[model samples]
Target: MGDHAPDGEPPPPEVEPAGRVITTDGLTKDYGAVLALDSLDIVVGEGVTGLVGANGAGKSTLIKILLGLLAPTRGRATVLGLDIAQHGEAIRRQVGYMPEHECLPPDVSASDFVNHLAQMSGLPRAAARERTADVLRHVGLAEERYRPMGGYSTGMKQRAKLAQALVHDPRLVFLDEPTNGLDPAARDDMLELVQRIGHDFGIAVLVTSHLLGELERVSDHVVILDSGRLLRSSATTEFLDSTGTLLIEVVGETGTQDRMGQALAAAGLPCWPQGHLIAVDTTRATTDRDVHDVIRDTACDLGVGLARLQADHRRIEDVFREGGDHVLPTS
Candidate 1:
């Protein structure tokens, strides 16, 4: 009746195993009159995929549905070749989830809590303990593993949460706001750790955040959501490619940028002042003479030193302001 195959039957292989790690089709969720997720579709491949959106953008709701903790009102999803509708328990066993908010008990030590969770994931007692130790060390919490989590700092608590998520040695990890409340240095450390989990450990990661720029450094692909609707999903490099605009900076007198803008405008180029630099729209340039040559010659004619000239790339936030219509299918 829905886009998914019948329960107990596997969905047709929409993509090669090496290409996609997860897929969803027409996934929607509603709370009475309010729709948390509108008929959405997406594909996540191997490596670190950043899911970005502002607060109350249904990012948390999507994670819960993927983990099988919350049911979608329509559509279906698959994770690691298992149906979320029929094999949620099996899926949870193979996948690990690090929730957004704090969930640690004040009375328990990090080591013990992580160990218990590993065992609950079906690991033997001895294996769980060993795995817990390895994960704690990897997360850089070896020294404080035995201390009460109540006294731990925010960064330390976040590390503990990450340790538990890795204790089970899951094939894929869903990290929800793993860097929340972290300072700049701590956030960088967390991001580096996330990169290692995907690169060094050969595990797939789906990390979420409201910050747009932070994930650009670490994510292989990005999926942006707005009001529970898909905005854009593509490889990180695709978003950073040239947007037909070049930013030019000149060094000379105090108003060097202004001088360059005026010279370029007089040369029949569409140029304007932007802060200390001038933005030149290259879309109008003639094919015979490249835009770069035009800019360089114009600068030479004006006798102003060209400090920097490069194409202006699009940022993730541009998707919202530009109302991006590019949506990649789950298949």
Candidate 2:
């Protein structure tokens, strides 16, 4: 379900859930004079929603409160229609969490740790072992499932953590910085695993990370937080729309970059040099249909071999900087 708030404001109290999987009402938390979370209200749909913010943006505090690890100083919350206050245990039973920090025992193997977690979630001994094997393989830890976690690389250790989270076959999972400290390839693999956990397994995912751009490729929706308040929340497509700014790519040395910019300017296209790229301001590029043609003509006129040309899509970070107002307002 999606938010029904007019002008992007927080949905009203009387607004019924349109298949909303999670909701918070006037949630607040304070650490003495420090307000960790304001009167925050939010609605989460039934797919992967990325929680993005810098450190101390109340991301961790919000997670703790939702998980029932921290009680709100004011207001209330519900997950899967289960009140966090009254159904903490029941909520936890169906929700799996992969913490940002390392929590595995050095002496234990991935198989051992996952099996134990599965049993803790109330799976029987034999079933826990069987489920553990499936989860480990799903996270791509087949060969090293029996090896001690202490010897595992950061990537391997992360996979083990993910395995344990999936051992119980949760309906929803929270992954905190699952790609932290991994190389590019490993990060991509982890992202693919996360995508499958949400789409293929039909499980809801609420993943958090300090890096905003990283979630763009995988998340179905994104929630931006700042200073313990809701900054923005919207479908990924809203932020990734490329209907604005002109994207231009030219071939040649750095000198070609300047030549292209000068050529576009001579033709009255409001353009600027953005590192190796040239960004044309489409706010006044004749018309939307003519923008691409203008870029192509300018590039050819400069004798600059064009490599790529298209509308510039806003990155995740761009949306955050502009607040949700640029795409959708905060009601």
lDDT of 2 by residue, 1-331 (tens): 1112234333223423655667899999998878989988988887788888777778778888888989999989988777888766666777888888999999999988898888888788998889998999999999998999999999999999988888888888889889889998998899888989989998899888777777878899998877788888889999888756876889987688988888777777888887677888888664445767777877777777988777778776665556544332211
Off by over 4 Å in 1: 1-16, 123-130, 250-270, 294-307, 324-331
TM-score per candidate, in order? 0.79, 0.78
- Candidate 2, residue 182: Cα displacement in angstroms equals 2.9
- Checking candidate 2 for backbone clashes, the offending pairs are 8-331, 9-330, 9-331, 10-331
**Model 2, CA-based lDDT:** 0.81
**RMSD for each model, in Å, please?**
6.1, 7.9
Clashes per model (N, Cα, C within 3 A): 0, 4
lDDT of each: 0.85, 0.81
TM-score of 1: 0.79
What is candidate 2's CA lDDT for residue 146? 90
